[model samples]
Target: MRLQKFMAKAGIASRRKSEKIILDGRVTINNTMIKELGFKVDPKKDIIKVDNKKIFLEKEKIYIILNKPVGYITSVSDQFNRKTVIDLVSKVDQRIYPVGRLDYDTSGLLLLTNDGDLTYKMTHPSHEVNKTYIAEVKGIPNNEELKQFKEGLKIEDYITSPADINIIKKDKGKSTVKITIHEGKNRQVRKMCEKINHPVIKLKRVSFGDIRLNDLREGDYRFLTDKEIRYIKDEINEK
Candidate 1:
C-alpha cells in the first residue's frame, strides 16, 4: 500500500496528515527515511517508523464515543502540551484518531477510532452527515433572523448550507437552541449564530449522524456498540 495509506491504517494519522508527515521526512521504512507519497511498503515485512518510533497496524479496531468537555482539544496530541481528547481515553490500548472536530470550547459527542476508512468517509464533505448541536446564544432570534438562519446566512466567504434550528428554552438574556447542519466547518455553529446577531455563549454537540451523546457525562467515553458500528459502516457502504 502507499506509505500515507499505511500510516493512516496504522492509526498514525489521517491520510491527508500522513502525506504531510511523509513530505516532512518524518517517516522511515527499514531505517531509510522516505519522503515519497507513493512509496509502497508491505505491512507484514516492512518496518515502518514514525518520528523514530516503530508503528504496526492495529489488528483490533477500536471505536470510542467521548463526551469531550471544554478545554480539551480534539487531537491526538497538542504541540503546546494542552490536554487532548486522547488523554481522556488513556486506558484504551489501541491508538485512535478523532473522526471530526469540536472546537476547544465546545463539548459533546466525539468519535475516536482506528478505522481509517470510516474516519475518511465520515469527515469527507461529500458525505454530508448531519450533526446536531445545542447552543446557548446571546439572545432569542427574532423571526427574521430565524428565517435567515434556515435559508442560509453568509458567513465570511461562503454561505452556509440550509440548516435546522429550534428554540429549546428561553433564559433571561440568552436562549438555548438546537441547531443541525450537515457541514462540519470549523466553529460553524458559532459562526452561524453570530451571523444571526446571537453569538453562542456555550455549545455542545448532541449527535452526529445517528450517533447520539445520550446520557454520557462530560469527560467520559464508551466503546461503540456492535450495532452502531455496523449501521455506520452500512451507511457508508450504501454511498
Candidate 2:
C-alpha cells in the first residue's frame, strides 16, 4: 500500500495529512527517510516510523461526537496560537481529528474519529451530508429575502444550493432562523444570510446529517453510541 494510505490505515491522520508528514521529512520506512508521494510499503513486513515512533494500524476504531464551543478551531492544531478541537479531546488516548470544520466563532455538534475512510466520505462534497444550523440574524428577513434563500444565493465564486429555512422566532430587529443545507462551504450559513440582507449575529450548528446536538454542553464530548455509528456507516455506504 502507498505510504500515505498506510499511515491513514494506522489512524495517525487522513491520507492528505499523511502526505504532508512525509513531505515535511517526518516519516521513514525501515530507518530510511522516504518523502516520495506514492511510495508503498507492506505493513506486515516493512517497518514504518513517523518522527522515530513506529506506526502500527489500530485494531479498533474510535468515533466521538463533541459539542464544540466557540473560540476553538476545528483543526488539529493552529499556527496562530489558538486552541483547537484536539485540545478539548485530550482525555481520549486514541488519535482523532474533527470530521469537518466549524469556524472559530461557530459552536455546536462536531464529529471526531480515527477512521480515515469514514472521514473522507463525510467531508467529501459528493456525499452531500446535510447540516442544520440555528442562526440569529441582525434583521428579520422579508418574504423576498426568504424566497431568495430557498432558491439559493450566490456568494462570490459559487452559487449555494437551495436551503431549507424556517423562521423560528421574530422580534423587533432580530430573528432566529433554522437552516438545513448539504454544502459545507466556509461560513456558509453566515454568508447566505448576508446575501439576503440579514447578516447573522450568532450561529450554532444544531445537527449534522442524522446526528442532533440534543442536550450536549459546550466543550464536552462523548463516545458515539453503537446505533449512531452503525447509522453513519450505513449512510456512507448507501452513498
Candidate 3:
C-alpha cells in the first residue's frame, strides 16, 4: 500500500498529513529516511518510524466533539505562538486531531478523532456533510442580499455553492442569521457574508453533519455515543 495510506490506516494521521510528514523527512523505513511521496510499504513487513519513534497502526478508534472557543487554532501544533485545539483536549488519553479546520477567530462545534478513514470521509468535499452556523453580522441583511446568498455569491476567484440561509432574528442595526453549507473552504462563512456586504461580527458553528453542540460549553468536550458513532459510520458506508 502507499506509505501515506498505511500511516493513515495506522491512525497516526490523515493521508494528507502523513504525506507532509514524509516530505519533512521525519518518516523512516528501516532506519532510512524516505522523503518520496510515492513510497510504499507493507504494514506487516516494514518497520516504520516517525521522528525516530516506532509507529504502528492503532487497533482501537476514538471520536470526540468539542465546543471550541475562540483563540485556539485547529492545528495539532502551531509555530506562531497560538494555542491549538489539542491543548484543550488534553483530557483525552489518545492523541487526536481536528477533523477539519475552524479559524482562530471563529468559535463552535468541532470534531476531533483518531480515526483517519472517518476523518477523510467526513472532511472530503464529495461527502457533502452539512455544517450549520449562526452568524451575527454588523448590519441587517436585506431580502436581495439574503436571496443572493441563498442563490450563491461570487467571492474572489470562485462562486460559492447555493447555501441555506434563514433570518433567525433581525434587530435595529444587526441580525442573527443561520447559514448551512456543506463546503469547508477557508474562512468560508466570513467570506460569504462579506460578499453580501454584511461582514460577520460573531460566528458560531452549531452543527456538523448529524452532531449538534446542544448545551456544550466552550472548551468542553464529550465522547460520541455508540448510536451516534454507528450512525456516522453507516452514513459514510452508504456514501
TM-score of each: 0.97, 0.94, 0.96
Q: 53-127 in candidate 2: lDDT tens per residue?
A: 998988889999999888999998789989999999999988888898899999999999989878877887789
The global C-alpha lDDT for each of the candidates, from Candidate 1 onward, is 0.91, 0.90, 0.89
For 1-239, candidate 1 gives per-residue lDDT tens digits of 98888888888887888899999999999999999988989998999999999998878899999999999989999999999999999999889999989999999999999977678788877887889999999988989999999999898999999999999999999999999999988889999998989999999998988999999999999999998898789878777
Q: Candidate 3 on 2-49: residue-level lDDT in tens?
A: 888878877778888888999999999999999999797988899999
After TM-score superposition, what is the CA distance of residue 53 in candidate 3 from its true location, in Å?
1.5
Best by TM-score: 1
> C-alpha displacement of 122 in model 3, angstroms?
1.3
lDDT minimum window of 10 residues, candidate 3: 120-129
Least well predicted 10-residue stretch by lDDT in candidate 2: 117-126
Off by over 4 Å in 3: none
TM-score sort, best first: 1, 3, 2
